[model samples]
Structures are given as C-alpha cells and as structure tokens.
Target chain A: MPNLRVHNLTVSLDGFAAGPRQRLEHPLGEGFEGLHEWMFAAMRDRADGKTGIDVEYVERSEENIGATIMGRNMFGPQRGPWQDESWKGWWGDNPPYHNDVFVHTHHLRPSLAMEGGTTFHFTDEPIETVLGRAYEAAAGKDVRIGGGPATIQQYLRAGLIDELHLAIVPELLGRGERLFDNLGDGIDGYRVAELVGSPAVTHARLVRR
Target chain B: MPNLRVHNLTVSLDGFAAGPRQRLEHPLGEGFEGLHEWMFAAMRDRADGKTGIDVEYVERSEENIGATIMGRNMFGPQRGPWQDESWKGWWGDNPPYHNDVFVHTHHLRPSLAMEGGTTFHFTDEPIETVLGRAYEAAAGKDVRIGGGPATIQQYLRAGLIDELHLAIVPELLGRGERLFDNLGDGIDGYRVAELVGSPAVTHARLVRR
Candidate 1:
C-alpha cells in the first residue's frame, strides 16, 4: 500500500508550525523568517548548501509523490470567497509540484491547469473523500500532504497520515498556530521512528504504530 | 552575579513538560512513563547506563547548584493547604537535592528539613522575592530552577532565567501541561545556543541573548 506521507514540516521549538497573521508579504507569517533556513541551506542545487542529513530528508519529500493535498491557506493568502480569480498562486508560472494538487477549501473553484504538469483541483469535500480522490490520482504512488498546519492537523486527528516528518526549528514563535495542539487522541497511534539533529534543526520522524 | 539556570527539563515532542491529571501514583502525570527513559538510561550510577550526550546533559543539570527553586506542584501532588505534613516529598529520606530548596506556594507551611542537605521551605512570596532568597541561599553558586512547567513559565515570563536546557522527548502525550504555552513575549529574549540529539532524545539549550 502506498503511504500517505508528510515531510519536512518545520515547527518552532514552541510547537508552532507557522507564526501568526500569515499574509502576502509574509507568507509563513511573522517571526518565522529563519524557520526554514535549515531546509533551504540543504538544497541540492545550491552551491553553498550543506549536504548531510538535512539534504537527504529534503530529497525524500519529493520521492514517490504522485499527488499532493493542501489547505486553502497554504495555496494563497486570500481567505473566504476568492476576491479575484487572477491570483494564480504564490508560485509563478511552472510550480515545483509537477503533479495533481488538491486544495481543501469551503469555496469551490474550477480545476486550474498550470504551466507545468501541475493541475490544481479545488474541493470542499470531507477529509476522507478528498484523500480518496488524491490516492486515486496517485495511481499507486504515495500521497503527500502539503500543510499550513491546520490541514495536517485535520489528517493527523483523523489518523489518516501514515508517516509524519517534522523539522523542529530551535526558535520560539511564542504565539502562533501550533501544530501539536488540540490533537486529543489523534496522536496516540503514532510513535517516533527516528530522531536526529543538525546544528540548525532537529528532525523527528513519527510513524504510525 | 550568580546565574539562574534550568537543566534537564524534559518535554514531549508536542511541547508538554508533564502530562495531565498529576497524582500520587503518576508523578510525571499520565502518558509520560517513558519520557525520562533517555535520562534514566544515562544515569551515572547505573551499571548498564549509556554515557555520551544524554549523560553529559544529566551531569550538567547537577553542576554548581547551591540552591534549587520549584513550584509547589513540583514539590508534591497535594494541592491547597497541606492536609498532612507527613508528606515530606515524593523523594523519601535523603533527596537528590543536597541544598536549600524553595517551594513556591500560595498556602505557606513551616519549613520541613529532610535527610541529606535537602530542606523544603514553603513560601507564598512573589517570584522575584523567592528568587532573591534563593540567590542569597546559594551564596555565590548558581541557582537551579527545578520546574513543574508552571513555575518555569513564570520565571521565563519575567526573564529571570539566564540559561534554559530542554530535553525534547519523542512522544506524543496528546494532552498535558505545556511548558511553552502562554509565554507570549517572554520567549523573545532567549535564543538557541546549542542543539544536539541522541537516539533517544534531542537536547536544546536556550540562552538569554
């Protein structure tokens, strides 16, 4: 069976996946500027990027992923009904994801075909239904859950996620949308499979038990 | 000036310092049984204990501490006025803390001197005042902030702690008393000075910057 995986989800030491008040200017919200520095520093193409554990994990995120699912918040800064349809998304022209991407949203939109093989499907369907569609689109490949914290929390609470990889950044966001809160018994099924650290971040891989 | 430091404060990957519904049988609270296994495995006296990063941190928690301060919750499970003074503490006879220990409480009780150098002084004094007394008790040695999470949060909010060391255990308690919640701007003054990981746990040291 193909695994439903979430990889390289960066969170602060305080457990915040992203800082408060995410906007166009500050896509990841405030106080989260340096949160993804470790991943960015380990980019495969970058000349100055460090090659080690961080890079290896970054590479794994793209492996065997045929389809991606994300919350509407992660797609753009706009909320509620779309003010303008002109907003193609944060990524310009050809996005990195060259596969089918499902966007979880209350407001429905027509299927959007982008420059690359990427096609954005907007759906207001329940988590299970959306996941089923994503799995079908994956066609035997693994499904990847792209997150804005809330999206991942939904999957986590439902116990639909098979593997969760977290990069714990050593910074305190103090106040923000916490990734681990309101989990209740949703986290009971998971256990830590691996824990390693670089100078910049600690990587914890949790697998469903 | 003697620095106020916190060490070996273990917290779950979800950021809970202790699990919920703390009681006599459950000292660290429910769902937290194996949270401290990493430190326990690195005990200096244990024949089978492993020595390395985990052990080094455990040893650091005991270094240069002339006095220790903790919240009432950390001292005992009993709440409100002490129904019975018979409960010296969770530790029997000679406690590990061989120094003057201050317990922050709203319901003050007479000081109970235990075996070894451990002496529990219960006081309803303000955090700053208690810290002042603890500093004086230390003479010139550094003071240690032994926490139950709430106590540590208070000192962190006041910016009184000079150094903070956290052992991030790889477990999901789901629900518990979080160490980082309600910190607000209190966490702004600190920065991650060191971060390392063992197979069992990840250690993060935050210093006031």
Candidate 2:
C-alpha cells in the first residue's frame, strides 16, 4: 500500500510551524529562521559529510519520496489570479518534486509542464480525489502530503495517513501558525516506531494503529 | 521607511515549512514533535514550569499578536458548505491570534469571536485591504500573516512588509510547500542586519532596500 504519510515537518518549541505575517520575499517570518538549521546542515554538508546518518533513516526519509501534493501557496506567495503564470514552480528547471505532482486549488488552470519530469495538476476535485490521484501516480509507492499545514490537517482528520517522520531540529518560532494548536485529544492511537537523536536534532517515526 | 523584512519565520534546507497533511489532531503533521527539542526539553522537565525562551518572545509572539491572516485552508481544511458555525478560529481558549484576524476566503462567513482576544473576520477583501485592517488592529506594533504560503507571497509582491526572520532547520521534506517557491526576482538590496548561527539553526534579518 502506498501509505499516506506526513513527514519531515518542522515546528518550534513554542509550537509554531511558520511565523506570523509571512511575506513572499520571506516566507517563514522574522526571527523564526532559527527553526530550521538542522535541515540546511544535513542537506548542505553533514558534519561527517560522508557515512552520515543511518542508511535506513535517510532512505526512508530523504531519498524515499515518490509523488508530491503541493498546496497552491506552496507553489508561490501570490494572491488573486496568478501574475501571468510567469511563476514556474519554485524549483528551477529541475524542481525538487521529480515524480508526479498534484496542486490543490479551486482555480481551474491547465496543467503546467516544467522542465523536468514534474507536471502540476490543478484540481477542483475533493482532497480525497487529489490524494487518490497522487497515490495512483505513486504506483504502490508511498505518497507524500506536501503541506501548508492546513492541507496536512485535513488529511490527518480524515484519517487518511499512516506514518509520520520528523527531523526534530532544535529551535523555536515563538509565534506563527502552529502545527498542533487545536490538535491532540482526537488522535487516539499511535506508536513510536523509530527514534534518532543527533546533535543538531532528533528524528522519529510515528505510525498509526 | 516600509521595510520589507522577513521576521520570525523558519525554513529547513529542503524548504518544507510545516510537515505534510496537517490536521487538528496532529497539527504539526506526523513527527513534528521532533522539531521542538529545545522547547519540549525545557517545558518537559517540569509539566507547568516556565521556559528560558524569554517572556517577550513567548508573550509577544503569541499573546500580544494583534491580528493574523491565513489561507482559506489554513483556517480549516474543509471547503464549501457551512459545516458548523462552531468552528471558531483554529485556536481555542487563547488562540495565538488574540486580536482581529482577517481570513481570506472566496466563500464568506460572519465574523467569529473566541474565548481570548481572537476574532475571525472573514473577508473577501483584497490582500492589501486585509493587511491594512490587520495593521490598523495591530496599532503600530506588528501584524503576522500566518502562512498557507500564498498569503505571505501576496504581501511580498506588493512590497508591504518591514522585517523577515528565517529559522533554517535541517531536514528534507523533499516536497510539501516551499516558502520561496514562486517569488519573482530578487528582493534586491536586502541585507542581513542580524544573524544567529547557533541554537541549532541560522537566524538572520532580511532588511529592505
């Protein structure tokens, strides 16, 4: 089964996912940059830089991605009628999402063909429809729910997810949108399947019952 | 001068702000509990004890936050049809947004009030109009545009911001939302006024031209 998973999200000790008043030029928010150092170092240059992090974690975490679900805002920081579609997907000629991709939006625009294997499907269909599309696109591989928080919350509430992997960076975003403000109390059963603690941050995997 | 600043926001190198498929129960989306080692460590030691993150960052970031703006999805994953008027703003007894919050929605709803200083003002208003209202409600303090992604991009494109701070955590969502995905051109002339390479991430100031 291509499990529905929410993986690799970041948050502050104070429980913020992103800061308040996020702007296009700066998406997170001021002073909130401290929330994400762990990822940059891991991707850019691991301290070891070689035989770093357990192979299983890296494979199941980083290189394991199959298809992506990008919310409209994640596509760009624009509002009301895109500016001439001049905005290609955020990544350059080769976007980070190389497999099939689905964009969630009410705007019925044509699919965008990017330079690489990435093509964006704009859907007015229900989220379940999108999830199914992405899953089929994944072809028995796992489907990653690329979130803006709200997107993830919707799926989580629908009980559509299976696993959640996190790279626990050490930091705090005092304020902004929180990943778990109104959450909890509803999630009844989950078992911690894996845990990795490093100097920069910890990594853990949570699987639903 | 109106400073185009990126304040209090954080990002991982892989550029996934929040985890994928966020929900009310697991708001941070799967394993996000790993992201807040510092905060959790501090708060965890003693259930109801105070943390060292400072009252200013905590109170100002969450308490004094005058107003907020979020994408429609950010407000609730549900779309179309009034499921229940009971879905007051996402936060409960004390939502992070304690003042007036203008939600951007094509589908409109009446203004909502919560326990704390939070109010949900559904606006079909333009992004600028929402910003103006939010700024006014903030009364020269600061207004936070909580991210769904597109909400923040609109402000940046309009050049209506002052400061932006980013916390770069280490992790690869490989997919999900990219905070800077569709930004047009370089914000140009912006300089780093402050930078923190410690505390697990790099916190930097982005000042306008």
Each candidate's DockQ = 0.79, 0.03
Model 2 chain A is weakest, by summed lDDT over 10 consecutive residues, at A180-189
- Top-lDDT structure, candidate number: 1
TM-score for chain B in model 1: 0.96
Which residue ranges in model 2 land beyond 4 Å of their true spot?
A46-49, A54-58, A182-186, B1-209
Docking class of 1: medium
Q: What is the C-alpha RMSD of each candidate to the true structure, in Å?
A: 1.6, 14.5
Q: Which stretches of candidate 1 lie over 4 Å from their true place?
A: A44-50, B45-50
**lDDT for A2 (candidate 2):** 70
For candidate 1, lDDT tens digit of each residue in A1-209? 99899999999888889889999988889988888888878884345654678888898998999999999988999989998788877898898889999999998889899998999999999999999999999999999998989999999988999999999987878888999976668899898888899767999999998
